[model samples]
Target chain A: MDKTTGIRKRAWLLMFVVVALVTATCGNGADDTTTTAAAAATTTTAAAAATTTTAAAAATTAAESMTVAKVAVLVPEEPTDFGWNQQGVEGAVAAADAAGIESEVAGGLGYDAPTATLRQLAETSDLMFAHASGFATAAKEVAVETGVPVVVWGSPDDREPGLAAFVSTSAQEGGYLAGILAARTTQTGQLGIVISADDFNWTRHSGGFIEGACSIDPTIDIELVQIGEGGYADVEGGARVTAILIAGGADVILGNGDGSSFGMIRAVETEDPPAGADKVWFIDVIGDKTSIDTENILLSSILWDFQPTYLQAIRDVEAGTFGDVNYDLNLATNGIALLRTENISDELWAEIQTARDGIVDGSISVPAADTRAAAEQLLGCGA
Target chain B: MFDETLITAVLVGAIAASVPLMLAGIGELISERAGVLNIGLEGMMLMGAYGGFWVAIETESIWLGFIGGAAAGALASLVMVFLCVRWGLDQIVVGIGVLLGAEGLTSLLDAATFADTRPRIGITARLDIPGLSDIPVAGRVVFGEPYMVYVTLLAVAVAGWVLWKTPWGLAIRATGERPEAVDAAGVNVVVVRSLAVLSAGVFGGLGGAYLSLVSAGNFIPMMTGGRGFMAIVLAMLARGRPLLLAAGALLFGFATAGTTALQLVGVEVRPEIVNSLPFAVVLAALVLLGRNEFLPSALALPYVRGER
Candidate 1:
């Protein structure tokens, strides 16, 4: 009977430990709530402190006052890949340099790594720039915890409340420009597009390119290929797919993948030139390709400059005027531009310029591929 | 698109994917044949990849970067050897520790060295053999390859020959099968086992170099993507035979290539689902093969001079 009683007591103790563990796990959500509340309290206290200081300073009207704020820029990949992430790094550096603000830059923070790094930086920085769509979730979570504003780059979507704003170049306009270039350059009447994947972003660009090209010549054939599994990282896969397209008589090719575009460029570089022909033309995305000298290749590029948008956001943050709406930097805002060199014919240049003017003057509004309505209406395909 | 060219594409993808696995598998085969199971193959490959990529980026030469990667793998292996062989630690535990340490070290060092640095080495163009490259799909699949691919094939051939047709191979196998007998024959069992482990490290490191320098041309954290462990699986499936391992590696490569190809044909499968195919296939193979028991006798056993 005594042994049975001892066993029952031990069993009760084991149950208590299990309950404690379960409670601890459940308490994590409660702790998060408390942290947010604490952050809100701190924010209120800081506002009150600022109000008192301003009131006190009103008595000493002759005193000059200055405030210094620290800003941080975070990137998801290397800054020198001559592609996606590089643009963000360059933009942040240029903006910070111009404003003469003390800033720190962190790059190559993988999917979840950005949240931890951003949280650590939040303790010191007055504002943070989260520079990738993949980094948006973590940036939003950290912004809520720290009660600080975060400015993210990429097409605006359903973002958290603290995401002050989003800045992005109009991808559809860029695609339209690429289509105009491809239509003019194609000798076989068929232009090929090798994208990184079949994501909404790539589909928008490809759809716009196709529509723009067909607008110029209804019978023009446009073959769209995607390195579906590679996800913008597979250069070899891109090269192989590009080679196959070129072999299938695609005279002009346009690449929409960031780093994977290098593969397409290489494929064009290695292809044997026709007798008496100088080179084949290829269109570039994200950054300028006019500088890369390859015989008759690298004809034009669509350049997305984040400098103006990023600087404006920083200025707004410093002035304490951050807001929730996205700062759309479309072609109308001079955020996206079509860059062509003397290598392109003057006649073709005039044609592209007409479309550019039309976009800027609000005569043309390029639809994005994010919404079902836009995809169905613009792409003529149901989601 | 579904004509004879499709066959060529499949073959080419298989060969390309098999190169890294072949290198790492042959190394693991030798290491396991010597009775030291090194599960840190993946981590070691990652280290080599980052090291090779950084060196090549700084030196602007792929060859130097390849050497740097091999050295890095060897250094990582040396740590495993010290823990398992010298300190008499548990082989599996030591390997797990090494794997974790190498992974952490690679990520930390990659962040420190290559962060915000855009470093790329020009792809080594295909080597065209005069008449051989003109023959249908076989020509494009086999003849049109980078120099590293040729080296991998040669390494596999050489490894097979060395393991099955050499006296040193016999001694090494004997040490694994019966360390007492080999020690009684006056062979320095420690030296042979250490050399086997180090050679395995070199092969794994080369696999990493191929990934960082040749494949991606830039270092991404954890970029080996479990290829090292996959190589070990290939080694096991082949029963330590280099030629069979090559075949196994090609099977994995084809699975990956096919998954990508299917999506390109507008098969509308979620990418995450496709990515999981190769791993799932490997797990199934392991379970099925485990039931049949086609493993080396002394595969995971560590050698002790006088123990049973």
Candidate 2:
């Protein structure tokens, strides 16, 4: 019996050694990974801290450095596209130039590409602006990896530590403006707003436009068409849908899709005018007719100035106080503006100007409609 | 809303869309005909797009971008050749590896290259054949195109003629059909197959270059957007005949253009559903084509000397 017990004990001891060997191997492997992660985190923190210090020192020693601050702007589309992406590019370039910073612009890069670009800029540039919400993931990853403060425009994610801050314009307000334009311009009493499906940003714009138009003229018939569920690269679908709306007698059209907007513009341009009647008008989003060079067709545009917000976030980054929260740029802050042009009659222009002044003076407080309740309150609608 | 102009638009759009697919399909056909199946065409095309765009942006020359794209594709294919030929790795797994690797590399490189520099090329100006351009719908469809469209057509014609008429083509067919016989005939089958795969890489690269340098005039990650796979499907549909490949490519292009046109005309159909029609058609075609036994007998078999 003792011999059998001894053998069992030996077997147990052997099993323990085997288990210990396996445990040691796994623990060592995990330790290696954790160490590398920790090292990366430390390096990133150091780099970020260094950047902050350098910025502060540069401010103090402005005369000594004599080197202009450099800002890098990354966009998801060509800067000259005359749209939302273009506006960001233009604003960033103008802002950087005005601030005496050397500005560089990159376009046609997706989320992953911008991250690497941001990292490279973080090493040298005073500020880096990732100019699209699509770049949020890449920007966040790179910012954390490189410990660089990245300022993203149109991004909703405010949780990352290295993310300097987001500069968001009221897309809802822009939508409301589009609605007002459509409502005022439509003679057929039928207007249509074509949105590129259910993006939160597009939804806000579409919802706000619908609300604002309904508020102005409750009897005006409004048709809301959502084109394609997948994200906004479908220009053909946009064109097709716009044609349908035109067939249905929508005299004025508003579109919030990026490249898809070009299709809508094309549809209207090619549409045959009703005999002896005025041609249909379009309200452009993010840019005006000046960018696209089409004035007769486009009535006006809703524009955003991202410079003030971008600069503010850069300042925070330099101060080493980058926070996680949405920085609201509303009509009151001169962040949003409606383009003024001769095409708009003096009477209509005066009315829009009055509304603008009211918004600025807080008399007509356009309730910030980020939520469903806010949207309802702003539009004074029961939904 | 559906008129002669719409029909013309569909025709033009189809021809335009066929350029990328034709280039990639012809390349893939050459590779497959040489007994090497490369599923890395997608990744290679993406790398080529970015490389071409970057080169064009830097040099302000579209031709330079095209060359850069070709080089990038060649480099990418070299990786595949090394794995499959040198290491004797499984071609499918190696292809998947190559696809993933190329994607990651292109994404990283694209960011590094384009960061803070938005470089764009002007759209290819339409070339109008004075007499032909006056023919209304047909004129717009046939005469109104950039030089690249003509090149794509010329490429298909030349590839078809070469594959059927040349001694090199015979050797390639021999290599793909019965490698043992070709090896006994004193031809280095491996070398011929590698060259075919490399040529395919070049064509795939050019296709990608065309996308960024001519078609879109800019680069985006994954911008090849499965055109490479679509090209492979086209090749399968055409059964490796270049002329038939061109027709199949045009069909796909039409489907794509039709879907887009229909959406533009406000057909109230869900965009998602409409967008998927082209892929569905391709799948259906594959099912129908699968019954035909036209594939090269030795296709996908690694040529090992002295193995029974």
Candidate 3:
């Protein structure tokens, strides 16, 4: 209320943030580390104004930090579409529940300035999960100002000890498995990769897919096309590109997009198969659309489940090592996986499992491709 | 690679993609010519998409869906009419509000109804032109297209005729150039602008309906994906020429399909640059042609009846 009181509150807040950072960065996920940080946060909150100096000194100790009781996740869309936004929101909620904390979903925030929402969520939330890659900049700033540990995406370099952590999808492994499935399933020996955007994640998938497909038969024709620079939601564009891919004699299609995946599926549905093929098959990336696959063309999906990854982030905070790790969703970690449906026969599933095991065991090295050129090099496209 | 079948398919795909932009662009050109710069075309299209999808699903009639979509978009334009046209508010701000409002409302309605079903519409049956439909390649693509494609072309032609060959066209142009002069001429400037904006909304809505019912087969959130903005750019670059607007929209569509063609044939190029080729090439052509100079002088300015 008064100037001195306001100054004391500010000093107390600073002490808590510094203490949390120091404790988190120094300790491990041991019993003592959790107790020390939790106790420090509890003690500082109890008498922040009266003992600001003591609290500041206490916070510097390796074991002293704040207890995160609640976590909040922000997304640009509602979690009902069973896709990226839905998966992110649901994963955050699941992670919070696993971490024994309260979860707040700030969904449907739109692709705009999220500084206001991040700030508001930071006030009450201990760790803010900025789900969308678009929220990375604003979330990092909010974390610094509010002392909240924020999880952002796109750049692993953005991770700061006790402040912000980056999470990215390791789609290469799943892409490899998808490639294997396509190679084994396709009667025509032609595979398609329809990318909805100029995304590095998809490039990685393309690389792995091409490698896996070529590994089966070196001369297998692989057609790949991109919708546009930012065609994440370009459903019509996805459909049209997919049709072109089909026309190029691709019977097995691997589609990577958010909403555009549905269009790819639709294109596959409308298109009659080429010679030596019975029906067109589509392999989707990220989130399963098995429920909406009325045409029965969906073979599988490269699923990215962020719950375990998010839970590990909470565990890092508990051990005072939140921002020390670049969280990844990979096949080895079961973060990235291939979806199975009735379309995948039992024998194919067993074969796919063997490949998955190989990837996890490090026996099969699925090289990462972060660009179309790199992917073409790996897949031998145009070579 | 450029075989007749592939070329036909590519051309057909380009037409499907360009139809929506053509409708939205020609409508935007009329509105800008009448002095109202609408940034809410995206919202109008989005709302129209939902309206059309819902009606089509309910009635199992694609035509009804188109009409419903246009009506919904025109209805949504009432906000612009009352705010910018009547009360003379900031056109850009009101346009943004309308966009946001449409997004929220459509998303909410969709979640409530279609979230579970995720209903998809198949391509509507083509309106086969008697003998024209039998021709090779071009026949199936041009004459075998659904009725909406013909209506879109007719709408553009009609818009051009009204804008260039009618007294109303003179009044609309005069309103954009010198609204005070149009008022002195005893023609209500507000009424002209209102009609222009309303027509734009109608065109945008119909385009959205086609996008959902025929192009995509379903409505997804933000399905328009800045196409309304692209239409705005096309309209500005067309220099008030409807045919040029159609050409610009088709050029963009072909450029998009070209990326697919290049990649499918195993062309080893930067896919990122390839993906952006449509906008980059279209905008470059517009700049080379010096068409942006034709932008309406009084665009985005809210005119009070008596004030300068």
Measured by TM-score, the strongest candidate is 3
Task: Please provide TM-scores, in order, for all candidate models, with all chains considered together.
Answer: 0.79, 0.62, 0.79
lDDT of 1 by residue, B197-227 (tens): 8878898999988877666666766667677
TM-score of model 3 relative to the true fold?
Answer: 0.79
Candidates sorted on lDDT, descending: 3, 1, 2
- Which 10-residue window in model 2 chain A sums to the lowest lDDT? A57-66
For B168-280, candidate 3 gives per-residue lDDT tens digits of 88888888888989999999988999999998889889888878877767788788888888888888778677888898888877766775687656664554564465567
Better of 1 and 3 by TM-score: 3
Among all windows of 10 consecutive residues in model 3 chain B, the one with the lowest summed lDDT is B268-277
> Candidate 3 on A1-383: residue-level lDDT in tens?
59999999999999999999878854542345424444444445545462433433443333127577888999886666667887888788999998889999997787688999987786677788898878898887556544578899758778777777898877899998899899998988889898877677888899889888877778888867888777777888888888777766689999988777767777787654766899999998878888777678889898989999999988887788877788889997888999998988899888889999998999999878888768767755435
Model 3: residues with Cα > 4 Å off, grouped in runs:
A1-68, A109-116, A134-147, A154-166, A271-278, A321-325, A381-383, B1-6, B33-35, B83-97, B107-119, B126-140, B143-147, B161-193, B264-308
Docking quality class, candidate 3: acceptable
Q: How accurately is candidate 2 docked according to DockQ?
A: 0.06
A355: Cα error in model 1, Å: 2.8
Cα error, residue B294 of model 3, in Å, equals: 3.9
